[model samples]
Target chain A: MTTTTATHRGFWYRHPNLRLAGLLSAPMAWLVVVYLGSLAALFITAFWQVDDFTGQIVRTFTLENFQLVFTTPAYLTTVARTLGIALLVTLLCLVIALPLSFFMARVASRRWQPLLIAMVLTPLWASYLVKVYAWRAMLQPESGVLAWLIGPLGLESPGYGFIGIVITLTYLWLPYMILPVYAGFTRLPGSMLDASSDLGAKGWRTFRSVIVPMIFPSVVAGSIFTFSLSLGDYITAQIVGGKLQMLGNVVQQTYVSNLPFAAAVSTIPVVIVLLYLAAVRRSGALENL
Target chain B: MSISRPTKLILTFLALLAFAFIYIPLIVILINSFSTNKSLTWPPSGFTTEWWGRAVDSEGVRDALLTSVIVASAATAVALILGILVSLVIARYRFFGRESISLLIVLPISLPGIVTGIALNNVFTSYLGGLTFLTLVVAHATFCIVVVYNNALARLRRLGGNVEEASADLGAGGWTTFRLVTFPLMKSAIIAGGLLAFGLSFDEIIVTTFTAGPGITTLPIWIYQNLFRPNQAPIVNVVAAALILVSIIPIYVAQRFSSDTNKGGGIL
Candidate 1:
């Protein structure tokens, strides 16, 4: 350490830029070459196509991989289905998290707030596979617990398909939704609510007019997690999706047999998230996250 | 805010309902770990400690547990070094492309894990030799670094350069200033960050699935495999119950550091 420090005293001790360069080199090299480079290579690989007749993959740059992704009904439908599920999950999470978050952020006593947040967050640590599997048990038909519980209501388990996927995803990601919304709600000034009410706005009106507008960015921030996560997740869908395949499933399935197509398929989510990030950047929700 | 009794009651009811909804699955998982029913029908037909014993004794569970700990520790160690370096660069420097560097660092996380997983898989298969335990560690460390980076960056931002300058002015060298002054102040934040990173990597399945070789199995992989198998399903609950219990300490530590908005992403 002393020898290294003495050497550092030679040049690094004098030049701040050299010091910065020295400090940044390892991490930058690791992240840029390892992570960003991989992504760039993968995205570029998406453009390479295989010769169907020759049964050979060639790295000729072509739009055919993306063309197939954009044009094929199966690919298009999968994208839509994935996006649809993502949107639905985001919406459902909002519905569940809004009131729950409001309760934590505003309605619940300050003493209970941290506990509530912790309760919401603890599920995250409980292994994603386990939570999805637990839902798998509940969503099982016939002898499933959900069946037993909802049997009296004459509604069976959603039975591990699209609805099952959404429910399980909503369950998995509810905390992601709750926390951002809770933070947003926590950030909302109490005086704003009072001002709204004092201005003769009713509770619903105050919420609609004041709270909703103010909290919308946080909602957007939360939705980014729910939507993007559900979009990319194939595991939950694998456990409980039962014959239903999403875009993630498409990519995973195709990756082994058709790497180029899979890479192309992966780009759809990346593009969607980039666009979503761009949209939410205006909402100022990115910083809130 | 104006509150009505009925509204308060309704909000309270919703909060109670939300808590129940969040907790019921966890409660069921815990109960089923004790339940004698191997097939896992709820209401927990009967209670038994036998599964817990079996789970503890199970070689597969033990091995997978060890594998998860090893992978998480290696990943966290890498994350600790790289995160500190990245944070130091971003916090202390006012150089060209600084913001871009930060964005580059965060992209691994913000991009879908699948993108990251498959991209790394692509590179590993193409150039780095096919997926292995090392690949798994690299993949996990890539994402885990973000937590540590955020926490340390937040700490650096909060602490500023004054203390380091004071040490330097007193004739302490850069290394000395760091070892004696900066490191102690950054220790708790790094611990908080490392804990979050460990937790993230421990539970991670997406990236691990892509990077793990045919022979490797982390705990989540183990859980996924046994989740639905008729005989082993019950034991999964035991493992999960234990994981959840053990994971709390890290989550709590993370929340304690949540005054830093960067760590406010919290358990996610």
Candidate 2:
């Protein structure tokens, strides 16, 4: 009885295309049309002008929004500041992640590596708002723990400003950096390190020659997360950035009143990331996704 | 392969420092939840359970928690179905755009989430009526699919086609082979992926902020609102400390399912 049903269904399944289509239809409809189409639709909206008086989108086509994004010094500064912060965060994460991930991947006892990785991952489950707010409390100029800890040392908390935003964001995204770099380090063969040092190379020399090149792609892979995440983050800036604003804050502020203009500013980060992704595609970093 | 003693010592010291940096804020949160001082003063003026008691009785916290659970569950369910379907297609069949599909799957996560949020917001507000609970689910499911796809795809690539072929040779139909054979093999990956998807959706704020309706409040959204208010800050800490505690089991279970062999694989 089952044999008969199997043979019957086998006739339709003989064609791989039909089977593929059957599997692909739902996901495709959801992803291609709903996800990609929405993105395309958004960019289309960016080409139109918003009516200033009515605060509504005007359907007529214009490049004025993009022009304003390019021409306006305030928007340009936001772009630079955002780009600067993203780069700094990525650099700091690399510096911190390399040493820690190296320890976990190579030096830690095999029995404990998984446990450490799990420990690293647990913080991710904590609420994002809570982490940012915790930082806000910690950097609270007068009453923050940071101030209390450092005041006797004749220093102050960076105190709810650009530096605070940097510290908070780096903390928030640290695990993302560590995970990939650790994975990269684990992939390294121990013999390669031995090979370099055996041939008269010192620690720093072998590290520069053997390790950095191998892990560069992974660093880029981690950067994709930290960079893009920082670019889009307005919440951290809102909480600890004092009066500082990023492109994200600008977009959020103008989203309702000037959708077209906000969309244009958003294109800056999107284009920059797309370009970065394209540059790193050769390294096969996208495959790491 | 081994470093000098000094280098090893330095690495270990830095590792400890990194762990401390990761954990201190969390400890502060745990402490602040019990702080008697409402203003979040340094060293905590006093310790009490009053905030935790208030949080337990708070109607808004309960309602927001329920909403977050519902949304995350729906998003996870959607992501699992779509992830499996997509993974099966790519893993089993050689289609025209096979390589590009992986890129497509990753696009949601690779793009800055704000871009994704506003893009979806654009579509929802422009054509699909105002943002609602469904829109939020859709936005979350988009990124959640990547975690599920990665887990399932890696497993499928490992499993290859032999078992499925053996089942087919024995006269098992596509549906029968899947139900009896492939599904069991893929179960762990799916569970790990689903937990990951659920976790992502549960804590997500940027995308949720854009797609959620005016009255809809997920826990993160609730935290964002309350953390900014002076009086509500302690209550928010209670909720956060509680969140960290409650979240451990799902993460532990997920770690068990996927195991350690995968090597630094992130679910999201």
Candidate 3:
């Protein structure tokens, strides 16, 4: 019986194409139909406009929504501010992540590495809103933990505003930056560092000339998360940003009432991220992600 | 690779500082959960378990928790099936557009959450009629696919096809080989992937915000709504504190499974 079953291959099993199709069809249909279709629909809707009186989306193709997004001073400022915030958050994460990741990857004993990585990763599983809320509590004007800590030092907490938003975002994304950079550090050969030192390079010189250049791809990979997350965050801004608004805030506010305009606003991040992805794809960072 | 003593000490101090930065707010959340102050002011005037008791009894909390569990389970189920299917093809066969398939899976997650959120929101409102429970599941599963895919793909690549071939050569049929060999080998990976996907879907807020219909409150949405209300702030803290404590289990379990394979670090 076993020999007969093994010798008699099913028709579907005899053909690799059929097998592949059987496995591939369901996932492909869902991804292409639901995900890609929606994205395409969103961008298409961006070119359309809304009627003034009926509060309805007009199907006619026009550049009015894009024009408003690009030409209006408020929208332009929001775009620039969002870009600036994303950049600042990325920079802050890189600064904090580098030494921390280096320590974990190189300096810590092998036994301690996994524990430290776990420490960094645990916060990621913590609820996002809860983390932001924690930051909100920490940044309360005169009576917050930060204020209390900095009070004796004569440095005031930056209250809830642009600075608060940057700090919170940096905190939220630091683990992402650390994990990739840590992986890069572990991948770096100790022989390379020894060779640099043996060639008479000082610590700073070796770090600048050898280390940073080698891990640049990892840095870029980490920056992708920091930049894009900050660019598209509204809740963080809502909780800690006080009066400041980013592109996501604009999108969220307008999406319900003026979807075409919101879709136009949404395109800003999409274009920026696509451009960023294209630029970094050459760096081989996409694979790291 | 030899570092000076001072430099090593400085690195250690900085690492400690970074850990503190990562953990301080969570510590604060824990403390505030017990604070008697209604507004959760720091340096609590007193300590009480009043909020914890209230949270245990809150109807809103119970309903939202149930909804979150259901949505996450449903999303994780869909993601596991889709992820396993895609990973099987990508790992077992070489094909055209393979890179594009990986890119398509990553795009849902790699893009900003708000972009994914608004894009799906637009489609649902205009074409699908309106956001509903199903829409929420679809949005979540779309992104959760990547988590499962990455874990499964890593395991499948490491596993290779030799075992399956050996099983077939021993007179097992195709389905029998898959069931006895491939399925058993990939079970741990699938569990790891499912746990991670569940955690992701459970905590998701941005996409949930856009995709969840009116009156369909998930845990994160519940936390968001009550976060600002004066009377609910303490209970919110209790819930958040409980979440931070409970989240450690799945993360630790997933870590154990992935580490057993020793293929990648922390499931990315």
Instruction: After superposing candidate 1 on the true structure, give the runs of residues whose Cα lies further than 4 Å from its correct spot.
Output: A1-10, A53-55, B256-268
- DockQ of candidate model 2: 0.72
DockQ of each: 0.64, 0.72, 0.71
- The candidate scoring highest on lDDT is 3
Please tell me which model should have the higher lDDT, number 1 or number 3. 3
Question: How many pairs in model 1 have backbone atoms within 3 A of each other, for residues 3 or more apart or on separate chains, i.e. clashes?
Answer: 0
Compute the lDDT for candidate 3.
Answer: 0.90
- Backbone clashes in model 2, listed as residue pairs: none
Specify the CAPRI tier of model 1.
Answer: medium
Name the runs in model 3 displaced over 4 angstroms: A1-8, B260-267
- Single out the weakest 10-residue window by summed lDDT for candidate 3 chain B: B259-268
TM-score, candidate 3, first chain: 0.97
Error of 1 at A264 (Å): 0.8
B233 Cα displacement, candidate 1 (Å): 1.5
TM-score, predicted candidate 2 vs. hidden true structure: 0.97
Which parts of model 2 are misplaced by more than 4 Å? A2-4, B260-267
Alpha-carbon error at B203 in model 2, in Å? 1.3
